[model samples]
Target: MARWKVNLAVLCIGQFLVMSGMTMITPFLPLYIQEMGVTDPHHIALWSGFIFAGNFVTSFFFQPLWGRLSDRYGRKVMLLRSSFGMAVVMTLMGFAHDPTQLLLLRILNGVISGFMPAAVALISTNTPREKSGFAMGMLQSGGVAGSILGPFIGGLMAEWLGFRSIFYVTGALLFGASMVALFLVKEKFDLAEAKKKTNITIVEGFRVLMKVKQLPALYGVTFVIQFSMLAAMPLIPLFVQDLHGKGELLAFYAGLVGSVTGFSNMIASPLLGRWSDRIGSVKILAVCLIGAGLCYIPQALVTNIWQLFAARFMLGVFMGGMLPSVQTLIRSYTPNGMESRSYGFNSSALSLGNMMGPIIGGALSGWVSIRGIFIMSCIMLLGNALWVRRTLSDPQLPKQTIQKAGSASHSGDDT
Candidate 1:
């Protein structure tokens, strides 16, 4: 296997473990808050949204800061730090006695959620540019796979081992990931150059970030993709309950449906990414967004759990191309030496979307059937398709221009 592939595998495994563990809390959160003595549905909804969005709020602001710091300090070190920080916070989350405590810990988790971004930056810089889409897609697949597996595992652990135990397990898994990165992930840094150059500040990076014309489109896509993706999350379990009620089949099939989506993401992500490498990110994104929109319509119409699962699986397949494509496009445009900083901005956009998705989903669920969220999601994705179509330029055009320029120069008299 190639070095990039090996690196991707290692990183993916770590991501799978970490995300699976962390996300275990999702299914049980509202119930946990209720158990903690918050009885009112409104209160539960409010607190749940707070806890859910807390990490993203902090992470959105903190990501760029961490990214720039990583650029100055080193990606490996930043990954190690974030992993360790997450381990400690997750363990503390298991021990929280109230919704307030859990919410605070979640915020702390967001503040330190840059491990994946750092890993992404490291891998992106190391891999050949032509192959970056595949590498990024592989990494994303690992996380999506974890997300797919997480709800099932989390539900089982919550039932069998207790919700508190899930936190401990999550903490331990993160700790193990940190250790693996510390010992196995190697990146040699230039101390001499580091000493000679001044580190780029967050404000400076933001200034440079604003100057990049491509950044807006990237940020817009980031927000839109996340909004579309996360809009589906809060409703998955609810939709299952609505379809099948509080039965063993509901829980079992819910897990199965969610897992199927992950399986699809795992399979489709790399293929789509590799496809993007050939076809270009803009076209792939446009197709994915439009396809995802159409797929959601069937989801809204489904009466059976199996139908919902099938729709979700299709949604996963279409959505799989999104992250890797965005990352590749960002990598293509980011100036040299500011890789982490640029990715930081990208991470912040994703975090913002993460924060927005659930709140919007939860609110929408109150107004419309759980399936209505799918309708809303479909609209969002269609909007994304339109937005991307309008803003995203063809990456291939520059290469064609370069080839044309070279041909013209060669045809002329030798200079």
Candidate 2:
């Protein structure tokens, strides 16, 4: 394999471990909170949302900081920081005596959550511009695959080894990932020049990056994509229960309902990513947005679990195209030395969406029901597609305008 491909392959595994370790507690978070002595049903619901969103809320603010540092120093160091930091926090979660302590640790997890962004920065900087879409899609696929398995493994472990033990297992997995990255990932960064150019104030950096007129729109697209997808996620188990409540089949169907989308997303990401490389990411992004929007309509109307499965599978296929396309577009629009920072902002947009989507969706479910949330997601996504059609006129920048993901130093473009 080529050097870039090798780097990509390593980072792909890191993304998988990072996502799996983080999500390994997903299926039983509420139960874990209950175990921590919050007995009321209402408290369990509230604490679950709090614990889940806290990391994202902190992540929304902190990811850009890591991005800036990665651009200044090197991407690999930041990846190590995130992986090790999260490993520590994951293990600590296993020891929490109460929801308060667990929530605080979750917030700390968000503080160090830049493994994917750092990985993306590293890959985008090194790979040929034409191949960025494929790299990103592959990385996303790896992460989604982990997410699909994490819950299943967590459930089984919760039965055999208990919930806290699973946290320890997650920690070990993350530590293993960090060791892989430390040994395997290589970069050709110029440290002295990177430090020299890294003096721009955070305010100045933000201002300079915003000068790329196309970026803000792309960030919005990223936000809507995550928000639309995740906002509906928390409601799925309830909807599955509504569809088929056959005791053991109920749990199985609910897990299947969620996992199938990710499974299809894993299948579609690389395929759509390769396609995006040829035709430009904007067209793929727009069509996928519209397709995803339409796919949700069937989901909103599905009376049977099988109908929901078909719609979700199709939705995943469309969703597979959205993020990689957006990331590619962001790379295309970003200034050379500023690529990592731009990605940071993009990740921040994603974090914000991740934090707010569930809160709003959960709130919406109270008034409109689960079906209504689906309809709402459909409308928001189609509206975003229209916005993309009107607002984004991609600079049509030439493929030859490749910039290394280093600092303002252009002398080391030898990679």
Candidate 3:
């Protein structure tokens, strides 16, 4: 098999295993906190917030650092470290006797869960330029699949073996994936290039970020894009229950809904990527944002589960293109030699969005109706579309450049 394919396989397996562990915790976490002998509603709410937000809070700080480290050290080493660290943190969460302990562990887990960006950097660095869009789309789809699967499996396992077992299982899977990474994954890092690094400080990453003109627009678009996309996530299970009516398999149904979105991502991601190659990433992303905006409106109107599913599916299709386009755009924006660190900044944008999205979604859901959240999501997406149209350049490669780049691919080595 080609090196790119091998890398994809490795990433996909690891993503699935890790995601399965994560999903197992998502739905049951509140219950787990409650079971920890917490009786007060306010305390439970605060504890829940700490549990969920803890990892993201630390991750937001650590993600860029990890990205830079991956660039300086090796993405492979970072990947292994993240996987192993997640295993330890997750396992510890299983053993926590109180909500406080769990909260601390979650925070620790956040600092360690920097693996995703590292994996992305690894694959993006290795991918042939001609196939970057497709490759990125594929890798992201793997993550989506894991998100889809996590909640369902987590719910089932939590019920069957108890909440604590879910953590144990999740830890084992991640630990096993770490072992796979250490033994099976091989990478060639540039010692001369990495070693020749000048006196670049960690603070300098912020300066580098400020100096990149297009990066601000990219960051803005990313924030709005994820805000729009994840604005519905916090309400999904509730929506499912409302539309379908509660059942013995409520969590499973919720998982099914989540998985359906991943299913759509799997179907649409590659098509969007290949299409982006032909027409340009910017145009496709523009259309996707517009379509996604429109799709959210239908969700506000849907009364039944099937309609909700259709709306989510359409939203997924549009979203599938968004990240790949952003990744391709980041590559286009950064100097070729700085691809690793440039990607680190891009990853930071994504991590920030991920951290903020659920918080905003939850607050919106609390303040307004779930239907109102969809309207807000539409506005956010449309706003991003307009912003991108005005500020960002089209991502189309020049014809001569495409021909030269494509010809070079035939000789091997994208760089």
Candidate 4:
């Protein structure tokens, strides 16, 4: 296999481990908080959202910093750094004596989080442009598979052992992933070239990127997708409970309902990714946005857990195409040597969405109903789909123009 292919495989495993470790505790966060001595339901809900949002809040600011650093120091090093740091933080989370400690640790985890984005940057920078869509799609499946399995495994482990043990397991998995990255992933970073370009600041980098007409719009898609997808998450368990009428196995059933979409996403992402490579990423993205928006309608109307699962499964099929297509478009629009920074900015956009989505969902749920949040999410996605259609419809810029701009910007003093 080609070196890029090898890197892709390593990244896929790394992404899987990172995502799994991150999500393993999600299904049981409230229970864990309770274990830490919180008795009030309102307090538990507040802390849960705080701890969960804390990670993305820090991540939104730090991702660009890490991305810029990756451009200079190499993406592989950043990947290892993030994974190892996360391992340590997760292990500490297992030992936290209170919700405050866990909350702080979660914030710390966010501060060091960039493993998946680094992996994406590495693959995007290394893979041949023609194969980028397929590669990104395949890479996305790793995260999806991890997400699908993580909560299920966490739920089982919570039943068998406890929530603290899940953290230990998650930490160990991250450590293992870091070791794998150290041994297996390779990069051809030009340190001298990077050193020569150290004068360019992050602000300048953003300005340069925004000069590209398609890039800002692509970043908007990133935010919209994450925001819309996550808007349904905070309410899923409650919805499951509503559907199932409360049982001892409520957590398990809720976990199943939560993971069903990931199962379909893992199956569909690579296929849609490859198809997008032949047909057009933008076209696929537009279709997926519309399709997923439509799927959310049925989810809002579902009468049982099975119906909700079926709706989510269909939503997954549409959503599987969304991120890969967005990433592919990002890869296309990014200038040659700024891949990491571009992906980093995109990651920040994603983090912002992650931070805001659940809050919006929670707020919307309180104001109207859980079903109303689904409808709201549906509207956002459909609106974004139309925005994408309008914004990305211009004729492609000539390759020579992009190459010229890339060369000038990367030559060390041109910020």
Which numbered prediction scores highest in TM-score against the true structure? 2
lDDT of 2 at 137: 97
lDDT of 4 by residue, 284-370 (tens): 999999999998899889898889889998988999999999888887777656678788899999888888887787777888788
List ranges where model 3 is wrong by over 4 Å: 236-259, 365-368, 394-415
**Which pairs in model 4 have colliding backbones?**
none
- Alpha carbon lDDT of each predicted model: 0.78, 0.84, 0.76, 0.84
Alpha-carbon error at 360 in model 4, in Å? 1.3
> Model 1 segments beyond 4 Å from truth?
30-47, 188-198, 236-248, 255-259, 303-305, 365-373, 394-415
For residue 306, give model 1's deviation from the true position in Å: 4.0
**Of 2 and 3, the candidate ranking higher by lDDT:** 2
Model 2, 333-404: lDDT tens digits are 776666677788899999888877887998889899888888888998999898888766645652322222
Off by over 4 Å in 2: 245-248, 398-415
Candidate 3 residues 102-179, lDDT tens each? 888888887877777777777777878778888778777777778777777887887799999878888888888888
Please give the lDDT score at residue 344 for candidate 3. Answer: 62
